[model samples]
Target: MNFAFSLPLALAAALLDVTVGYPQAVYRAIGHPVTWMGAFVAALESRLNRPTLAFEVGRASGVFALALYLGAVGVVAGLVSSLAPSGVVGFAALALLASSLPAQQSLDRHVLAVARGLEQGGLAAGRSAVAKIVGRNPETLDEAGVARAALESLAENFSDGVVAPLFWIALGGVTGGALYKAVNTADSMIGHKTERFLAFGWAAARLDDLVNLPASRLAALWLIAAAAVTPDASAREAWLTVARDAGRHRSPNAGWPEAAIAGALGLKLAGPRVYGDRLVDDAFMGAGRREADAADIIRALKLYRASCVIQALALAGAALIAQA
Candidate 1:
């Protein structure tokens, strides 16, 4: 499709990622972008997030630290973007770099592995496979719990890991995508309520919330559309579920996709769950069956994959229209 540069860049990167995900060899060679960013975030936190500092002082330092790091990442991405020549090779190289930010293929593989583990070995295998993707305590999970956890992680991350980064890239190209990844990495690492990070993670958490706003809503809509086409999935219920339950989620962004997927598949997700001995009694997203199984995980994967296709098509359409 002949499209404008801004959106085309994101579309190209997304297509590239869907075609071939980040390579294991490349990761071993230089590490992934998020990991590299995490190293920087860890160093900055060690130096800036002092326990001796008072609450507000630590918070201000967090703001400063976030600004410093995000600024550095943005500058670097921009430099790389500028250095690329104005032709096919340069464009391909930039798109390749941008492709690393979205994890559509990997998310599918991880979530699917949970299904395979359940199918092949049972609860222990399911838990083991799921643990790679979710942060909740795997030992506390039963078969249903493992399935729910896997599906929940799949739904939530589809928004965060795939849609949000692509949304930024569609708007601002590689630098924008890189900046979002930096903020997200910071949030994942430090955005905790513990005494150690409650204040220090404020900026990262807040900004992540802001950047993810539009994508979350858009993601829900796409999931709803996906539900319409998938067998036995309820598009009507998906819309109703999102309208009724999306806001009930603890996260501003995660609930949208989670609720849509829950309603589409007629399953309950993200209810009470254990996270490192802490029980988070969050509201359930769908008023459907709580006894989710590997089959349901497969169902959710169908919806997730459909949603990805729908989103990519939407971006392509938007780009074509913009260029026209």
Candidate 2:
């Protein structure tokens, strides 16, 4: 798949996700026993002791998820294609592919849930939400800490949740899209700095980084463009911040968007946060506006929306060019 088809798929996916995702999530919640089974299986997988056993278990989990996702796509694509014209099948494939990708709405909802906990002054609730968003411990975070956690997640996931999947789908079709999701899921489940997963999970994590590189930079550029669109916003500042601070992040790819978002929002991001009992004094990104609150979260949400629009427009342009 190239931009010609991929653009429509991207748009369809974004639209479908925004319009129907909540209901679908609700329906899945109510109807799916498989979800419970998956959770149970994940629990079992998480508890494996031996490294070799863990690797085997991880591999099985990866293959299972890949097969299931791809199989579903194939079945759906076939059904849609059979009932309609080939063009319709193509469009439907795009729609189905889009449906698989996460949306800004979902991301905002999760972050807002955390913000609500923070506003209520319940550290535990806030911590729980933060933990869901980030890998860090919530127990040790302050208000600033919680805000940063959400912001960093917002930035990094903007690439992972939005950009990376679309990039793959456009490049390789539904199979590629599904494969990207599987790899990302594996990274989330097994990729960690913990002693147990250090060696085995390294491959998954590195592969994920490799895949995310271009998408991450694209996300950053989209963010910078978004910043330019805001009244009185400074593209120069955004560029400078991204250039200066993006490298400060631990992950090569993640810092790009985080830095861009911080620069766009004129806020500082990524400082020391508690991970379990240890404090990782990570380098901060951006310069102007360091202190964040609920309002900043709302701003980040706007940035998210703007970035999505930019991405869509870019895809559309690419499609038009291909046609030309």
Candidate 3:
């Protein structure tokens, strides 16, 4: 529960996730932790966010629902961690549970699919593959747009899907990680400025933003460092882009990693994009070429993989220091 134990636990979990991703068989049998959390989120939105309630009342209900979700996940994870036997077996069990938190392997698979689709198939294939990861409308995207969307998703998710969970685990062990994931799931499900979610999901959105603040910065650093060593990446551009253009992003935290990757790879990202009928006119990050392609996705994937190694090594170092 403390750093002495939790640091090593997190290191183990990250390694397991990288090497042995959550298997298809296991997922098919019981679904993943995130899926279970999604179901709970859906049920809460249905039961609590009623149209009949006043805006304030619905908002208050949403806050209460978020509290309930976090409480449930945290308590269960805490119990499991507490009841685990001492030594390797206990740590292994905890690692197995924690492995479910990071979606690194799955993220890689999803991004790679986009790259393959572009390389092997065509624009339609690329759009179909990118559609799975991004909320943007895929029908209108060209090949370059599809590649950009995939790369953008990779950078943002590297922070939310991988780094954020590890950050919480290092702080509060199983309980902390579980609670962070629950809140993040809530944000993804209902956190938006849309009429339906703007008021009702304010608390979840704000909390997710707060928890992700530090991790988002840390993720930026990871990418910058990884870029310094990568063959085609520009570390200087990454740092400059992050500093200059990250703030231009609509989401306070998402722009950091996205801008870093954009600068590192010398590609422009986050320009005008469509979501359904809505056109989001976001400022561009990284003043580089806007014509991204399948090759660019491969480069982004390399940067992503290198960043993962850096993160794992950093966590392992922290664990050793904690033990010392």
lDDT of each: 0.92, 0.72, 0.92
The predictions' CA RMSDs to the true structure, in order, are 1.6, 4.3, 1.0
Error of 1 at 266 (Å): 0.5
Backbone clashes per model, in order? 0, 3, 0
Give one digit per residue, the lDDT tens place, for model 2 in 39-128: 533554465434655656655554454345445644654454345446777578557645655555677788887778777866677778
lDDT of candidate 1 over 167-240, digit per residue (tens):
88988889989999999999999988778998899888898899889889988999999999999899999999
Q: Once model 3 is optimally superposed onto the true structure by TM-score, how far is the C-alpha of residue 126 displaced, in angstroms?
A: 0.4
Clashes of 2: 3
Clashing pairs in 3: none
**Higher-lDDT candidate of 1 and 2:** 1
TM-score: model 3 vs. ground truth: 0.98
After superposing candidate 2 on the true structure, give the runs of residues whose Cα lies further than 4 Å from its correct spot.
25-49, 52-85, 120-125, 231-233
Task: Note the residue pairs that clash in candidate 1.
Answer: none
Worst 10 residues of 3 by lDDT: 50-59
